[model samples]
Target: MRSNHSASRVVWTLTLCTSLALLGDSTLYAVLPSYHPAVGIGVVQVGWLLSMNRLVRPPLNMLSGWLSQRLGPRTPYIVGLSIGALSTIGYSLCRGFWPLLAMRALWGVAWALLAVSAYGLMLDVTVESTRGRLAGIYTSISYFGGALGAMGGGFLVDALGFSPAMFILGALSIGASLLALTLPRTQHLPARHVAPGVSLAWRPRLQAWAHALRRLDARLWLVLALSFAHRFLFAGVFYSTFGLYLQQTLGESLHVGAAVIGVASFTGTVLFLRNVVSVLVGPGLGYLSDVLGERSRVLLLGEVLGVAALACLALADSLWISAAGVLLAAMAYGIVPPMLVSWMGDLTRTGARGTIVGGYQTMGDLGSGVGPLVAYALAAAWGLSAVYGLGAALCALTVPLILLVRSRAAGRAPLAVADHGAHGA
Candidate 1:
């Protein structure tokens, strides 16, 4: 019963952290585009501003992980949440794009600190067998918060105006900050150092990070590549431009676009229920991978299915059709987190998990940052449909790369496979 209660608390803590992390992203989407048009920025330029938020994540993530290792995860987590809460309120005071962009960059730093610390904590508390499922739950809570923030922000913006909406988001973030304070304090192990009295230079950390990256098996790199492409396409087109697309292509109002996206996010959160299924099935899948020796094939198959879903979005003509496509994409999207993170855990030593995962997330942030610019350029040249088509194609390409990795790892023992299968994988 004690153990069960502890598990429950961990789950709640992770959920709350994820929700807080997502709030800024959700509210930014809600407030930015409408404000942009009101202030005379064109549709394309707005995409750039959205991309700016993601741009700050990679570097900050690298720093946050090191800081967490030194300071303990909870401090940075609390500080990040506080910053996010304050920044959300700051958005309302901004008069133009530059100020808003600056605020978003700062928000990205907060997101990185909180997200890296939260994930590190999640990993610390969870066992290997259950990792996949917990990742699903974490992501689900994130999307759910996104859905609520988007929906609530939209309604609030329509009813109360942008300033009030920002204030409300700020208040919610502060609430999350309060909740963050209750998280169990993590005990840090003694640091493993390379040399005594190495000054506070990032060079050693950067080199260590590079070595970790190099240590990633070719198959893992492929998975990372696929993840990169997936993020690039999604961030660039769907996330960055979807609102503008609805406005220009569908003749929808800003409120309507936010509603559609919010509803889509809610739909995506619903799909995360499958993570509960993933928790049940994830171990089975890991066991099956151990049994059949075809983990890569399973991953490839999932990626292929995701590609098809992206293609469906590309072909979608109506809003309903596009939404259906999103649902399909969500299904595929939901499957990857558990399997991929678990696989990474399988590959790395216990000591390096935080650093390695932080690096992977940094790469993800890099992909996310690049995605928007790429999509914006593509959209400027071709069309929105073309962007979707490219995303679909990229998803398809990842399958073969995943296959290559699977084939390579097939002969190796599953060293990292957990005994009881903790939920952090």
Candidate 2:
């Protein structure tokens, strides 16, 4: 029991570290587009600068996973946080395309390290009983960091200028790095022998990932597909286009039966409220899964909500109705992430956990990275409403996948899949 308490404390501490490391990244998003001139860049450069981090993450995530497997989570986690701190500081010091571009790529490296290590650490300290709840806790706290950074960083820049605000954020990131020192220097790895076809190199090989893929059965495959779809639609397509969607459908200002509200304000509020709902609901949903001893049921609820939300957005004409749809969308996405991640943990063992997480992150990044470009292209051919309807249809498609995974689980000796094909080390 005492060990459980200590482990829980460690999870909480790691969660805080993740939140602090996110400050500069989230702040940059809020600050860059509006203050391009102050940062010594053109409006054209803003999109590239913002996207460079995610564009660089796929390979880095694989590498981060390999590192977590080789060196344990502590060293790499601290290194990532230190790199993030330096990158945050560089944001204040560097200017122009080349220099800031390098910083953004370097931050990408840091995030890859941070994400995988934190995920690996969570797996290290948790059991099947505790995984869902702790995953929720991590998601809730980490999101709070992003929300704080987006809002607080903008406020700081307004009050103290960009350079000072960045410097302060860098200092906070350093503080988070310091906290990581409290974690164990080396975590226990469950398997003594490397899984077949997996390499020991710093850089992940395609064959290695291919081997990992071959090992996952249909259930895990569905989880990975859902991860991609979730990010593609919510993070990539919807967020990038929603503001424009509002402008097109409702005009620059939302008319609430004679009450006037700026579209920009309305968009920001809805998005921020979406984050707020995630922070509030993330843990509760995770806890519910833990109590029920099943994550797919909760995941199903989220998917249904997503379909309903997107359908509402596609058809609704009123402001309040749109807001309701946004809220539903928020709950939908908020529920999926923690539940899915925890579900993955439940279905995999510790030795191969990092690699599995790496694949999940890679898919998510690809989805988000590719989503907007494809969405806009599709929208041009079709329309925003049609694109949204397509998204709803795509979301609904996941329901069958979930039921398939659940049915597969039912056909086995309950733990057979988790213990052997899917969860084996």
Candidate 3:
């Protein structure tokens, strides 16, 4: 599969974009939790700020997906990369309460635009035979990028200054944008390309939305449900709670928190891996997913290990314990996402590729936004410990849901139309 030249080009370019974008994006989480107190805000406000960045994604994803085939992956890919570069620069230059919040809100849109386009493009290059390995490779690249960004962002702030670090990262992102232009011009063709008379008026967009909604099947809903739960626990409750645990409970400083957060938090590649097992073992694990031919089983095995690891992380009072937990969890966490993406690719049609990925991401984003708020609420009511405990439960809950999901059904031949009159499928 690595011998496939076109797929190789896709991976490297996509990997470069993921690395550079994450390098810039990682700067925010590097400082945000500890910086919150410096700015005279509290836990709840911090969660709100974090959630604000995720809140706008669902609708934007839908719109981006709807428009993807029309504009082609190339256009959005360029636009998204540009926005990512600018937004990191925005984080560096902005301050004050409302201004900062507004900036975060805007970054949310930039993130969705960039991510949906990347996912759409990744899928564009391969069919089902290559899907599992490609998905694994793509995710592996993202994880590796995230680790570099997390470590680099912290080291940069320490070596130079916040603004300087951001500027460097933003410039890298811009370079990746340029690299995107070099992607092979001949690739996946749109099932329906944009015509001259195409219009994005509200009526048509709304109709498309309604038509798409009616097309949703039991399998997609199950995947979305699994996606939602995965993010809600991992992204929301676990993230907000863990930062408080490290800072207040462990009495660590910002730098310590940044290093450890990536290890403990389930959310983004914001995780900086001191856990060497994941890095060393990543390719093998990815290969296992491809070889097994049963993604849900591999996914479930990882989830089980991840949930157990999260519990250990919650109670870890020493660095070694924390490292151990992170190592175990990383092994599992690394497997699940790529498997899920592969599964979705197996489920989707050529025409609805972007829309399906968009919906998948949209649900994940919703969980990301709502998860933190829910964690905050749980923390407020039960205590910070409860958030991790409940989050573990949520992770466990998804395994059953994964089992409930029927194996991926591909092509239009097997799919029954939900509303033939509306979509004319």
Descending-lDDT candidate ranking: 2, 3, 1
Q: Say what the RMSD of model 3 is.
A: 6.5
> Where does candidate 3 stray beyond 4 Å?
1-3, 32-51, 91-103, 185-215, 246-271, 274-283, 310-324, 407-425
Q: On residues 63-119, what C-alpha lDDT tens digit does candidate 1 reach at each position?
A: 887776666667788898888887888877775777777878888888888887777
> lDDT values of the candidates?
0.65, 0.84, 0.66
Candidate 2 clashing pairs, residues 3+ apart or interchain: none
Candidate 1: residue 317 Cα off by (Å): 6.4
lDDT of 2 by residue, 316-414 (tens): 888777888898988887799888888887776655567677888899999999999999999999999899999999999999989977987785532
Task: Provide TM-scores for the models.
Answer: 0.76, 0.91, 0.78
- Pick the TM-score winner: 2
Tell me the lDDT of model 2 at 8: 82
* Model 1 C-alpha lDDT versus the unseen true structure: 0.65
Question: Which structure is stronger by lDDT: 2 or 3?
Answer: 2
Supply candidate 3's per-residue lDDT for 422.
12
